[model samples]
Structure formats: C-alpha cells, structure tokens
Target: MQKLRHSSLAIAFSLLFSLAVQAAERPNIVVIMVDDLGFSDLGCFGGEINTPNIDSLASGGLRFTSFYNCARCCPTRAALLTGLYPHQVGLMRNGNSLTRNGVTIAEALGAAGYQTAMSGKWHLSRTQALPDHQKQLDWLNHQSQPDRTFSPVDSYPINRGFQRHFGPIWGVVNYFDPFSLVDGETPVDEVPDDFYMTDAITQKSVEYIREMSKSEAPFFLYVAHTAPHWPLHAKPEDIAKYKETYRDGWHKLRNDRYQRQVEMGLIDPNTYPKPELQGQGDDWGALDEATRKHMSQLMSVHAAMVDCVDQGVGQIIDTLKETGELENTLILVLADNGASPERYLQPGFDRPNETRAGKPIQYEGLFTPGSETTWGYIGSYWASAGNTPFRYWKAQSFEGGAHTPMIAHWPAGLKTKPGSTTDQPGHVIDVLPTFLELAAAEYPQTFKQNKITPVEGLSLAPILSGQQRAGHPALFFEHEGGKAMIADGWKLVQPKQNGQWELYHLAQDRTETNNLAATEPERLAQMKRQWQAWFNRVKP
Candidate 1:
C-alpha cells in the first residue's frame, strides 16, 4: 500500500512540474493598429462608438491617456514598427519606403524566434504619385489587357520584414474589389461575396495565429485595419444603427462627444474648454437638404466602420481564448494617427459609374460623402470633435494629430491593478523597446546585412509593473514643418502651412486654447530652438 501511494504522488508531482514548464515559455505578441481612428473613437476613449471588446480590454488592462503617434498613417506605422522617427525610417509621407538604415520590430522579433506576420494596409513605399505619367504607364503597362495593374515591388510589404503579408499595399482601395493584395508571394485577385475588408483582415489574422500556434516559436502578429478611413464603407446592417444618431450637424456632435469625454474622465473639464469647430463653411447651416443628408450618412458609415473594427477585435480575443493562449498573450492596440481632416474630390477616382462612356461627366457631387465611390473625408468640423477637446487635426504637430488611444493587455506579465489608467506621456517609438524588454529580446547591432540605428525609445516596462520611471525628458515632433516639443507637461506646437508658434502647459490645458507663445516668449524660443536642433540631427 505504501509503495502504491508513493508512485501516485510521483505522477502528480511530474504533471504539476510540466504545467509550470509550459507557463515559463514566452508569450505571443499581437499589435492591432487601426488606421486614421480618432482619439475619441473607442469606448474607453470617450467616443459614442460602441466598442465593447476594446472597452473590455481597457477595463482589464492599462490605458495610456497621453499616448502619441506620428501625425499620419505611413509615418506612424513606420515609427511604431521600426522604433525610429518616421523620417529616420524614410517613411516621411505616403509613398515612402523602409530604408536599410533602421530594422523593423518584425525583423528584431524574428531574430528572437518569432513567427512574424502582418495583415491589412502596408503603406510604406517610395512610389511617386505622378498624375501626368499615370496615364502613360497604364497604357504602356497594359496594352491589350482590359484590367490594368502596376508592378508589385513599387510598395510590397514583405521587403520590409514581415514574413506573411495580406491586404492592399496602397492607402485607399475599393472595399468590394481590393487591389495589390497577396497571400505570401502570389497575388489574390478574387474575394468572397460576403467579404468586408475589415472582416477579411481579421480572418486572415486568425488563420495566421492558428498556423503559428503549431510552431514552438512565439508569434508576432501586426493586424493593421484600414477601417473608419475614407472612403468609409460599412455593412448595411451596421450603418442602419447609426442612421439618425448624427442627423444633427457636427456642432451638436462635438458638444455630445465632449460631454461623454468628461463623464468618462478621459478629459478634465477644468483643464480644457470645449473645442470650437474650425474651417466650417460660412453657409454650413444654409446647406441644401440633399447635402445635409449626405453629410450625416457619411458620418454614419464612419461609425459603422469603427463598429466593424471592434468586431474584429472580438474575433481576435476569442481566437486566443480558444487556443488557450489568452493568458499568455501581450496585446497592444492603438491608432496609426488621429482623425484625418483631408478632403478628396468626389464623383469617383476611376471611370464614373455611368451608362455612357463619352458623356463628359461633370462630377455633380452625386456620390455619398464617405462612400468608396466618393473619396471624400469627414473634414475638420467632425475631426476636431473626433479628437475631443484637442486642437487641430491630422498633419498638425499639435496633440490633435499625435495623441492617440493606446491600451496594453498582458494577463501573465502586466500587473498594474485591473481597470487602472496611466497618465504617462508615451510615444509610438517606445513600443519596440518595451516589447524587446518584455520578451527578453535584444536589438541587433547589425540586422540582416546592414548596420541599424540604435532605438530612441526607452522601455516602458517599469510602468507595466505599476511603477513609473523618471519619464521622457523631451519628446520631439515634426511633419511637413509643423513642429512641437514636449518637455515635462509643457508643449510648444506650430501648425502646418506656416502657422504661428503656440505654447501651452499640456497638464493645465490639453486642448491648447491658451497660446503661451506671447506670454512666455522666452520659453517658446528656447523650445523652438531645441526642436530645430533635434530635427537637424534626426530629419531625413
């Protein structure tokens, strides 16, 4: 009897030890980036959009109230993925490529035995947008073919370190019929009838996760969704829900979002006043009924796009839970940039949807505002509110452009008490360093075949452990000459297209209403010169 009991005890002890060993293995990393999402889009971020999945993550993880990104899409992605400023990575704007100087986060993680994959928009490329040569190229490239296509290498994703790539390489595309998408090296021309771009990206990501689960190596999945960006398209069912909600113009919507933001504690009432709409047309109230309806419909579609993204987040979370990897996965979610205020010409980019070919289409603004056929955007009126009390919109060097919603979740590692928010001002560059430290991975001095620049961000691991570091001394910013410097909580910002220098204490006024440039001229001059010096060293 004693010998039998001893054998049973030995078996139980072995099983427990095996479980412990399995738990000691590294965790998978999933970085979900939403393109052109505003600061107030998510539920946790104080928007009216119902993003329960994302909100759940915030309720159970760390929410960074002052997270920053590069002022635009390609630049933000380049900086977030490469741990360098966008210009340093050669992605200063759209059509810029990832140069050999900086190593991507994928490359670094892959070196540490990570199965790297990326799905959805990959905008890092150096293709020149030449309207004059475009017609000639289309004719020359496809002489006899009805369907015209461009070369892949002009902006392929695989060349930039991701092992698996899917979705459009360009910035915008038809949601129904996407172009420049690939499954590995082969082109994917056909998509299912039930295909929504957001859903497709998520499905492909789920498939990648499943395939990588079989490998002993951990995985790094970059799921970049091109949702909620113009031309915004959403399912009919989803769009119907937000139909009458935005019937009121942007003025009312801005006020509503501001109230919600204050209620959520995302913004302090005493710190910043409600943002006033900028660039609104003088005849905004006098607009015709047709135009008013179209504008409201456009906003509805934008909201639905966000809803679809939230659904995608749900799918990813469910996948991890099903695979028993939820407990050990570190998930980071953020927007590529703040809400874009860019406006594109409507009436379709390609041949207009008309019966006659030689009718000489006049582009009478027939297409809906945010539809794929229109190519128009939700302008600064909506954009200002999209960013809540923040000033300006995308492309501005102010908080409105760079500040974004960032949430981090790690059941195994992040020990910050659940439902906690951090006021630490962090940037996209800090992500790479933080992940490297968490994964116990080292940045390669010479990645692949070329020497790489040292990472500029410090690891935010201390914050994850419910502690704060000394914090960043000076955070730099510049895009199209719009520049700013954040030292402690004071910010010095300049608007694009030759706007004057403005200064504010961010902690006291996050919206940047009080321009301290006149009051604190000496401080503004000092910071302006400092930013210029940093730009001299780092600018591309």
Candidate 2:
C-alpha cells in the first residue's frame, strides 16, 4: 500500500513538470531586414508591386509610418545590432569593423538561453583595405594586379554574436558571382546551377526556423537580404513578370504606387499630398526603342529582387505558423537603407576585368563593371520616385535616405490592429531595447574582455501597447554635415553644401516640401543648438 502511494505522487509531479515547461511565456523574435529598398517599394507600403505575404503582416499587425534607419547600410546594421549609435560602434565610416565591446542582440539573447542564427548580408566590419594597403587603389586605376584585397577583420557575424551565419560579409557583391560569402566560419564556394541567392537564403532561413521550433529555448533570427541593392540581378522568370510593367517609365509608376497606397489604407489620403516628380535626362517619350527596352529591363530586375524578399518573408511566417510558434513570435521587417541613385549607366565606363585574351564577355549595366557588358546606375530622377514623395537618396540625411517602412507582427503579444498605422518616432537603435523588454533579458556592461558602451535607446513597450503618444522627443540625425534635428513637433533640416537650415512642423508637413527656415529663424537656431549639444556628447 505504501508503494502504490509513492507511485501516485511520482505521476503527479511528472505531469506538473510537463505543464510548467509548456507554459513558459518568453517569445521568439525574427528581425528581417532588406537592403536598399525604397520607402514606397512594397505593396503594403504604397508600392504597386504585389507582396501578399508582407501585406498579410501589415493587415494583421501594426505598420509604422515614422520609422527611421541610419541612412546607410553598414551604419544601420551596426546600430540595430548593438542598440547604440553606429558611430559609437566604430562604423562612423563605411568598412569599419564591428568592435568587440558591445554585446549584439544575438549574443545577449544567446546568453539568456536562446538559439541565435543570422543569414544573408553582414556588412558591419571593423576594417577593410585602405589606400596604404599594398597599393590596391593604384592597381584599380592601371588595371594591374591589385596588391591589396578587401578584407574585414574580427567582424564576421558569428564572431560578434550569432551561433550560425550564412551570407556575404562585404557591403555589396554580384548576385550570381558573389564575393566573401560564408556559412558559419567556413567559406561557401559552390552553388547549384538552379541556385538563386535569394531563394537559397530563404530556404536556409526556413530550415533554421524548423529546427529551432523543436528546442525548449526560444530563438532570435536575423535574416538580412542583399536584394534590390545593386547589379539588379534576378531570375529570368521573375524579371519577365515585370518587364513590360515599368515600360511606361517612373512617372506613371509613381502615380500608381500613390494610388495603391491609398487603396491599402497604408497612408492617410489627406495627410500629405504627393510631391512633384523630378524629371531626369531621358524622358519616356524621348528615349529610342532599344534604350527604352533597357530601362524597362533594369526596372524589372529591381522589382524581382524585392519580390524574392517578399516570398522569403512568407516562407518564414508560414514555417512559424506550422510549428505553432507564429502566434508568439515578434517579427519586425525593415529596409537597411534607401534606393541606389548612382548613375551606373554613364558612357565610357567599363567593368574592370571584362576583356581578356581577345574574348568579349557580355556585360549588362548602362555601363559594366569588370566586363565589356555596359552597366551603370539609374539616375536620381527615377530614384526620386523610388523613394516616392521623399526628397534625396541613399547617403543623404534627408527622409529619402533615412525613412523606411517598418512593420511589426506578433499574434500573441503585440497589439494587433489590422491595417492600422503608427507615427511613433522609432529608430533602428531602439530595436534591441524592444526585444530585451519582451524577452525579460538584461543588458550586460561588458562582454569578452571589452568594456561595453551603454545603449542609448528607450524601450518601446509603451508605444507598442498604444499607451504612449508622440514620436521620440529630440531625435537627432547627421551624416557628415547633412544634418537634421527634431524637437517637439518642430524639425530643422540642413540640406547639402552648407545650405541654410529649413524648419517644418512635421505633424503638419511630413513630406517636408515647405521650407519654414525664413519664417522661423529663432526656432531653427534653438533646435540647431540642441542638436549640436547632443552630437558633442556622442562625437569626438
């Protein structure tokens, strides 16, 4: 009789143990970032391109209208991962290494018993080839053997915080023949004939999600894609879908996106009217048949790149749902930077290593890079419409460069208001704090024998809960003297070339078309002082 009583007690304890494990409340996180996507380039965000999977997230979650990036690729990634300003992380300029001081989101979450994996682009490096490095710059100029190669030290994704990472480590690489790619610590050299880089990354991400679902601990996945950024490569089939679509040129496309944006209810109809489109060198009616065809092809390639990213997003979301983890996983989707406005299609430009042994290698840009194939950038006129009603392009401190579409989706925890928009002031630096708050994790003061920089961001838990009002107060922005400052509802922006500061009440004019610099000199000066003080504390 005593034996039977002991057996009953053991059964009860085992059952309770199972229930406790299942009841754990910590949520998984997946932060997906795309490279160089335009603000109005997604269907959910007013772009005419069909991104149903992404649109689903917008329909089921909150879309942020006032989200901001660091205005460039490496800088934004550094800030997003470290929860500190990019300059503080040693990426004040391009090609700087991600220092060992701060704990990245992956490292922090990993310490808190989470599985961390990173895939796709990893551009944050502590060092790269400089002019003094073996005369590489001289070689490029003379087409001689380059003595120095572009190399990053101690800045690989896995080295920083991720347990597993796969993707290109450099800033940009050819989609078909990429450079400096790795899976974990090992370099990947071979790809199947049918291999599309975007599809491959998506597949790997899905597999990672599946494996993590079986683990007792939660997971944090950062999937960064090098799409729609450069070289404009895409599968032939995907390109075919958009071939004839953009033939009408950027003007029609911009209008179409604006109208679609209203239909999706992503933007307020009366909030801000569309800005005038700035015409470029070639008008739609002016270009010859062949030139027009080439333009259409280039635009098609760009669109396909985005479509691939959207498909990948859908795959991850579907995998999470299948494993019953979708409801609890916090998903944040954003772009790394603005659209490429460089004119890569200029005359007399050729790929560096294109011609060899009297054999012509077909290259395709308006001007080609290393080959005879002509390849060059599409100019600012098209890019203006790419960012859609926003001024300037990548590398600028203006909204066109800094502002991006941000979407958050969490079925179990985050507030779900389908088709709703939030104008809350949030920046890439705030992402780490938001995740930390959700996971109940603490930030460390130091890691790996290095003194860590304190995070300079506040948690957005209140904003997500819809309890807080107004964007972040005193938001500061700068990129080598192209500067802007926001305090209260007033914004002071300084254009390039030492242009006079312009003022605007952002709540009333988000497009920044009107310059109130002449009318509000006192307010502009006050805001300028505020920005200077903040920058002094953060800069050398």
Candidate 3:
C-alpha cells in the first residue's frame, strides 16, 4: 500500500511541474494607453516631448507609423480591449458598457492562467449624469454619494476579468479629485494634497507590477492614462519646462514637428509636404498679445500633462527592470486618440463648478490654467499643430483624428530591427489579438454563456518578426458622422461638417491635398459601395 501511494504522488508532482514550466515560459505583457495624445506628440514620433523611457523602448523595438485609434476615447478603448469593432461591442457612440458578447483581453488571458490587472481609466462603463443635479454635483465633488454604486457592478473592471482595478469609472475627470475614482468597486473619495491623476495612475501601475512579479504566472498589466486631455490640467513643475517652448506659436510648432518627422526618416517628405490644418486656422500670428500668451500657457499645460505621462512611462520601465521582468515582457505604448479640439467656457454636465474647498471654477476670465480652480483648453490652433502633417483633430476621420504613434518593445523577445519604423497600418482592435497571440490564448466562441463577437482585427505578431503579414483588406471608420474608408492605398473621406466625399490616392497624395473625386469617378463609386456595405454590416 505504501509503494502504490508513492507512485501516485510521483505522478501528481510531475504533472504540476509541467504546468509550472508552461506558465513560466510565457512572456509578461503590458499595454499602456494615453488619452488625447497626438500622432507626433512623443519624442520618438517626431515631437519634442521628453519621453526617454518610451523612446528607449522604441530604440530597442519597432514603431508602427500607420497605427490608428477609433477617433474617440471610449470607442478606441472598447475596440482595443475586445478585438472587435467598437460598434459591435456596445460603444458605437459611447455611454454604454462593454457588452458581454465581447471578451476582453484580460478575460481571455486570465482564463489561460495569466494574472491580469488594470490601473487607470475604465471609461467603458455607462457615464451618464443623474437626473438629480444636486446629487450629480455632490458625487462629482466627492462630497457625498453614500452609496458606493456609481456604475453597473457587472461592467466594472474588477468583474471584467481584471483581478484588481484602480482608477476612474467615468470618461471626464478632475485631475486632483477625480470623479468616479475607485479602487476595485470601492470609491476613493479623499486624496492627498498633492494628488495628480497622471501620477496616481503611474504609481498604481508600478505598485501592481511589483506585486504581480511575485507570482509565478506571467501577468498582463493595462495602464490607461487620462493625461493631455481636456481642462489642460497639469502640475506646475511639469508646465514650467514647456512655457517658453510653445510661445513660438502653433505655426512654428507644426512646421518644427513636421520637419523633424521628415528628417528622422519617419515619413517621406516627397509626397508628404507639410499640409494645412483642416477646418481650423493655422495663423497663430493673428492672435493679440494677451490671446497669444494665454494660448501659449494653455498649450504649455497640455505639454506638461503629456510630460507627466512620459515620466510615468519611465517609472514603469524602471519598475520592470528592478523586478527582473524587463526581458521577455512585451510593452506597447499608444494613444487612445488624436489631440482634442474642444474648448471650455464653463463647468457643465460632469464638469465640476466648484473645487472641494468650495472655490468657483474660472473659465471666461482667465485664471491660472491647469489649476483645479480653473478650466482651460489648447483650442484648435494648438490642436492643429499637435496633429502635425495630419489634417484634422480628434473626433474626425481624417489622418490627424485617428492616426497614432504605436511602439512595440519586448527586450528579450524582440526580433525586428531596433529603432526601425514600419508603415504597417494597424488599429487599436489589433491589440487584443496581438496579446492573444503572444500569450497563446484562445478566443472563445462563447464567454460566460454569451455568444462572443468574433474579433475583427488581425494579429501583428508577424510584423514583430521583421516580416509583413497579410494586413487588412480595408480599413473603415465612422465617428459622430466623420466617415472614411481606406483600401488599396486609396482613401475616401467625408468630414462631419464639410458634407462632401473626397478621394485621395494615399500613396501618391499622402495628405489628401489634391482631391480626385471628379477624376477617379469609377474608383470613387466602387469605394463608396464598399464603405456602404461595411457600414450596413457593422452599424450600431
């Protein structure tokens, strides 16, 4: 009897060891998404922002030049997490949950025995204000709301396959005392005096990385930052660095970024001559002295916010290095969308009117921008420069609206030429698919008894191996009536307010400067038909 028992124990030990070996062989993965960052805003991608950590990642990995987002925050996030078209995942126009029909990357990887955690924005949940205005204000100010329930419990990140979640549940937030700030399902009402939203997101991410490093199983960390977005909130020290830099005006900013892009071999200057801003003015010289100074201060605040995010990226890199997870860890850095062009006049909807100290927020009559007591925006002039070479800003289908710089870095596993950039067009939807490929996780036909939506994005693994995979046959886009279709190096775009369909041979024109709607009649009609077919199938 003793001999038989020993044999059975030996068999069990062998099986457990096999499982452990399999788990350790898998690489750790991290996805960092920043909000409202421009296509050329990062130092690695032609901007002057100090992003040494992210730039180092690019230096040791590869950059995707034609990466795209869904042209809005929530939509892009939904697509990125689920690997499905945003419309098919209950976020066609936002204010909805990431439907059960789609499985998140966390869910898939978690099922594959990988530990998962997310630290930052979780704007996939419903974000509508209550009918009671006082209650809404109370909740926004973090003064009240005895009830802990702000969003649907099922849709919260804690329940959405993240073993732990720490961040805001809503899209809009105040930097100091952010609305919808939560730790798992519990509300984080009070904060320290020096709490900055960007810094908090980074700290939590670093904390999670260290904690997860203790586990044997490889982990997945999603660090979604709400930096460089509206309200222009940033710290004073971060703002001071860029105050003098942006006073050169938007015209010079745009020209400088574009010139750097060409000189760095990021883009071919042959077909890509510096293009004019779409539906916005580029004449920064026209502003009066007061307006110019105010505008410069606003952009400085925006740059500071971006700089803070980069600092967080640096911290994350250091944490990874310290934890001995720098190698064999895949890190992807990309923006949620292009720079926002919206302006603010007052606190409306979720925007707060008073600080926690009962100070009235200032907007019309300029107060110091980036303070919790004031509201400010970079406006279209600065936004146009931010998007550089691309035509339109956020919420539009033009290149400026959807295009983003994507860096893929895996120190131990990288196979591509270091510091090289690829023109391979990729979308946020491809993110989940790439993670799945990396983790060797399977996408289920049904998750939690719900028939899951099929992934619309292709894997980018082939590109990482220094080879081209068969990319998308066509890329279709639509957000708030801004429409575009790209196929066979051809593009058809209709700006929301413009009300006209224009065609461009992207390989030739590159900037949509010369319209070919009248000349390429047959090709235009075919593309329109293709786009109409795609819309018909995917419309929400």
- Best TM-score among the predictions, by candidate number: 3
Ranked by TM-score, top first:
3, 1, 2
Order the candidates by lDDT, highest first. 3, 1, 2
Better of 1 and 3 by TM-score: 3
Candidate whose lDDT is highest: 3
For each candidate in the order shown, give its overall lDDT on alpha carbons: 0.76, 0.74, 0.86
CA shift of 437, model 2, Å? 0.6
Each candidate's number of clashing pairs is 2, 28, 0
Q: On a 0 to 1 TM-score scale, where does candidate 3 land against the true structure?
A: 0.94
Q: Between which residue pairs do clashes occur in model 3?
A: none
lDDT of 3 at 1: 82
lDDT of 1 by residue, 422-460 (tens): 988889998888777666678888876789898887667
Model 1 residue pairs with clashes: 95-125, 96-125
If scored against the real structure, what TM-score would every candidate get?
0.89, 0.87, 0.94
lDDT tens per residue, model 2, 178-289: 5556787676655565666788779889988998899988999999998877656677677667767888888887788778777766666465567777644767778887
Assess the local accuracy of residue 465 in candidate 2 as a C-alpha lDDT between 0 and 100: 59
